[model samples]
Target chain A: MRLRCLALILFSLSSSLARTQPDIANPHSEDTNWLNQYAHGLGEQHTELGLEALQLGDYAKAERSLLDAIQVIKVNQGLYATDQLRPLQYLIEAQLTLGEWHAAETQIEYFQWINVRNYRNSIFTYLNGTEALSGLLLASSANVNNPYSVRHLVAAKNLNWQAVNAIEQTFGSNSLELAPWLYRIVLNHYYQSTMLRRQGLSNYSFKSDSSEIVSGWTMRHNETLEMSYRIGKELLGRIQELFAYHVADHEQISNDATALMTIYQGDWELLFGNDEEALEHYRSAYQDLLQMGRSEAQVDRFFDRPVSLPAPRLQMQWPDQLAAESNEPLQFFAWSPMYPSASRPAEPRGDALAADDQQTALARFDLTPAAEDEPADTILADTNLSLDNLQILGTTPDNELTREQARVYISLLQFRPRLVSGMPVKLENIELEYLFPPQMSLLPLLDP
Target chain B: MIRSVGAYLKIRGTEMFKAIFALLSILLLHACVGSPAQSNAPRLPTDAEVEQYNASVPADEHIVCRDEIPVGTNIPRRKCRYVRDIQQTSTFHREQLRRALQ
Candidate 1:
């Protein structure tokens, strides 16, 4: 009885062990173990193979292997969790290399979701933005073949704009802070804008160049000038403050202020219908450029003149803070030059000032043109001064009034047609030159 | 007395061995069986097969394949009947085999 009981216990134990140790001979049974091992083994194997393929420049094969690894991981693990992300990353690289941009984009979106759920890690966020930008650029360029496809261009522009906004918001606009990234975004935005302009989808408002000009010359205008003068004054004040802050070098600030002043003068002339005055301002700007040893010829070219007139002295006031250090007496001369012709009263009856004398005074010094009576109706009617008949008389060298003849003619048509209708008017011919103080130089002063 | 005692031991030991072996076999077989029946498999047509099928079909009917017909085509009920038959047979065969093995 004891032996039988021992044998019975032993038999049960043997059978239990046999059951636990799965039959290795049965292909079906072995297949379960094989599949488990095969899946895990294949995942690791393909990962290595995919990496090797990528290194070898076999992108298609790399994509297949990487995708296979990812699929296996997905099958084994219900969700593609963090551990499986490595394979997915490889998959993305492979797809990108193969130029499967759409597929890569879809995968990037999935990866972005994973990153969001994990926590908004900076690396993933940056990668997501980069990949999206790349995909958008690709789509935009591809749409060039189909120029009528507005959607692609619009989408590309919006995406690039979003990227720019995101970077700006995250890293303040300080170039030092975001210099490494700013260039690319800026270039992209510039190029995209150019493309959109070419496509006729641009929302460009035709802002008159005279707007900035008008704002700068507020000091010269009496009452007719708009709110621009106050704005200009405020801008000057801010510039002074900026100089105090050492944010800008002195010479740069000076040049910028001078340019603004020149623009203001140009705007004043445009509004007041005084081309001669606008030409004077432009000449002053050219002088400022000359004082800095910059080329003066470009100024003539800019105004379409054979020779540029000399610039007038800028009536720039020193900041009050600098007053204590200066021992020299302050001179508050008018920014404008006192022209001999301008001093003479307008006489409707007297013979007009000699054209030669007027020309000589204008040529020797920066002076304003004298006003004259309107010419007879025959001359006015013969001259193409009508609203329907406007003409751009060729530009004259060193003559601001001549440059603005067209605009003046237009204004005459609109506002003073009667004066121009039958008037035989002789415009005063003046040649002006700009003069700059020796202290004004392009190089900034070194701090003592 | 010894003879009767030995006989009792033998019978008891053999019976226990048989029961354990049967249990083990059943467990192993259960593990060997794979995923459940997949009877709803798609009957994808090959390109050449599709071409031949298309050629034999009448133009008025516009039958691309038995699986796909134009909305207005009055397809014979027998065509769809075959699709149902295929599905039913596959499901029945798999279930019957599973039941027999179990």
Candidate 2:
């Protein structure tokens, strides 16, 4: 009876100890692990709340919350953790909205450092980080308020090169995965060409620290133009080769991809002002599609509308099966003063233009073909738009200055001509809505 | 009057060694004289190659290539130079012109 009473007293003492000092009762219940989990959860909660605040247009609050989340995550997950990347990106978006350019720039460098740490861990993680960083860099470079905009542009292009090398090393030299990255670099070449047209930009350095011109005086004006043309042409050829390799390996692969890439080849040529070559390529693609058993009407429908040159996406189908004509006004959001054809990535989080809360000006005009007369000579010419019958519908704020700006913006735009039966044709009653980048007053518009 | 077989064999061995050494010396000289531009570098680097090489280098050390027509020729030749060298040349020329004006 005494032994039984002693055991009961010991059990009561242990239960009481478990309640007060749980670590003593369960040795595995350390405070560090519990605090880590708590911190991670708190960080996630703050991130979600920050995103919500961003959506609600409270950038200052969003920035504070996202900063808090980043700090919490770094403390718990350890510094340079990839888990903090999403919150870091959102924080950059908030800072961009608040016109915090220097802060945003510094955060971008941190984001890159963290991303580079995870590169060797997994290719998917590397690609995800690169895509996010590239989009963010592009968006920041496009901002009018950014003093170091050109530097950001160069950095994004350089990042593309890094991705290309990584992919080539992981895969092979001619892997199909290289098409988008290579195409992105070609687009950057186009952006750089436009910058060359401006007079004082001759000394524009791609490096952040160096004041020396990127190409120095070795590349004359015309020679620089040729360089862009040659590089873009070679990359387009490489893309075609990648597609051809896949088509050769698999019998079920359609030749449509090759033909669609041919069309992009034409777009690249047109971007470089090689109208004759561009038209020849377009015609060849048209014939190739016809030979592939596509109906004339179907092919014509595919090329019915005018698209901006150097298409935002490298579509690999002769007839875009999912394309549907929309009655909504065509939205032409210029990415930057230098990159007129470049567009924001499909995702909205890293897009600084979307966060800018800028004005949108609606305009109506006739997209008449300037090559109507002597069509053979001027087919796909750079000056395909004559800028006649331009009418400004309205600006968001209903201001005279914005209306005038919209008119000038629309007048400066050039589009790939709509093709009918492989011949460029005129279109009427084209409505366009243009979004003016924030801080537009700071940078001068490029000359027509 | 014939020499011993061992002596004849020794002479032949020395001759063979001399022949091989001369051949190796010629090959080494040829390899040394070959231009890196012809042997190692692509005539005009593809965009990817240029970017890769540039990324592995510093900003001022970046190389730029362009087609140029020599003073007496109409045909264009591809010329490449490091930006640092180009900048130094430009600075030197500028200084010379300034001194001449002074």
Candidate 3:
């Protein structure tokens, strides 16, 4: 492996040198900068030595060598040149390990800006953040197919890496928090893959050329989903070792983890057309909500809520004495089960519930008000909006829909054109807060 | 002639006993060490076979156990004698069989 890396570095050096080799030997007489002239072959030399030192556990020497490489590369290639980023990464790590914060700060700053090319526009929205790691992260972000466009996966990915590094740097790799961070990294990759797929852009890379992963970053739908799912599956199992036995009392965290696993499993299965597994996930998610003391009606309401939680988290139950540690308690609801929903009856008795569902459906599109306040647009606004009656617009015919429902119908169409295309409409990131109206706060959480 | 034959029988009685013992040992070894069932193992019936067996059997008379299928027929038609499950595990279905037999 070391020899292969050496060969790769040498090949890169030769190629880079081939372009600038003539300029190095005969510093074009017009070139006034002595530093650029003398910097010939310095980057390659430093990189070679830095790698060797790194392999030999001479971090300080490796650090100096990589720092030299970064500077030489920056001088020969422009400061923001992609070639400089790799050496800068090595230098940053060396400084980090050597506790040279001031030095790493500069490297990270340059790395971060170059990762996004300091783009302040909307297109570069993904490339905002100043972590040196972002520079490394953005290495993969280059939408190689379009050299000019800023599909800056590098910045976001770098930020994720930086976050992970910081957490591990501070808390150590084995920290319980690291497990969730690992999950988040996988989540970020899936998001990127999904975004790419949505745009019909098949070509992508999740890592820089130098740090390419075994599974190439081609933005394949099943491959991306499978890769992320596999990682999530493995990480979730390992995370269970941290909290499984003690999670009984902290129903919310346990529920959240269970929900996360089921959602991952469910999404993966659904992606592969495994309806049974998807339904099983839905069933499990429903039970998880039920375990949170949410009744069937409440669970339905929970999913019906249109609010979005920005991130996934659950508040841990702490003893009254330790409650101060957990100031902001969150209850996370898994998103997958809400849409493409499969509802097992809240009560096992079948016909009456089906009758109620049919009646609800009949009234769902009715513009005629049940009371003075009810509007056709607000058909789904009720707390009794069970899974069976989840009538997202375009899912069913407008035969029963009064034209008054056009407002909501149009909005959904705008959100997902596929809704009207008669394709399956997938809902995601449904918040628990919107499911049950706040008025239901007075009701007790029902148990089976 | 009877006396001469009797004298010959008495002389060969020990040899006859030894020969009988050797034949029994050889038969025991073949039975224990080299049974044909080991090489030509019974195969399991697939879902289609089980469904076929279920359809072939009369509803009034319960379907034969997976092992008993195609066994008693004079024609010795080949069928999956090993009953594979149709809906769920065979064990669960076998419980149904147990209840039926009871």
Best by DockQ: 2
Question: Which candidate tops TM-score?
Answer: 2
- How far residue A358's Cα lies from its native spot in candidate 1, in Å, is 68
Docking class of 1: incorrect
**CAPRI quality level assigned to candidate 3 from its DockQ score:** incorrect
DockQ of each: 0.00, 0.18, 0.02
**How do the candidates rank by lDDT, highest first?**
2, 3, 1
lDDT of 2 by residue, A138-171 (tens): 6776666666667777778888888888898898
Ranking of all predicted structures according to DockQ, beginning with the best and ending with the worst: 2, 3, 1
Task: Report clashes for each candidate as comma-separated counts.
Answer: 19, 0, 7
**lDDT minimum window of 10 residues, candidate 1 chain B:** B59-68
Worst 10 residues of 1 chain A by lDDT: A334-343
**Candidate 3 clash pair list:** A108-A132, A137-A154, A138-A154, A301-A435, A302-A435, A305-A434, A305-A435
lDDT of 1 at A351: 24
Comparing 2 and 3 by TM-score, which wins? 2
Distance (Å) between predicted and true CA of A177, model 3? 2.1
lDDT of 1 at B5: 92
Expressed as tens digits, the lDDT of each residue in A50-107 for candidate 3 is 8777656577998988877877887777766766666766776556545565666577
Model 3 / residue A299 / CA error / Å = 3.1
Most accurate candidate by lDDT: 2
Q: How close is candidate 3 to the true structure, as a TM-score?
A: 0.31
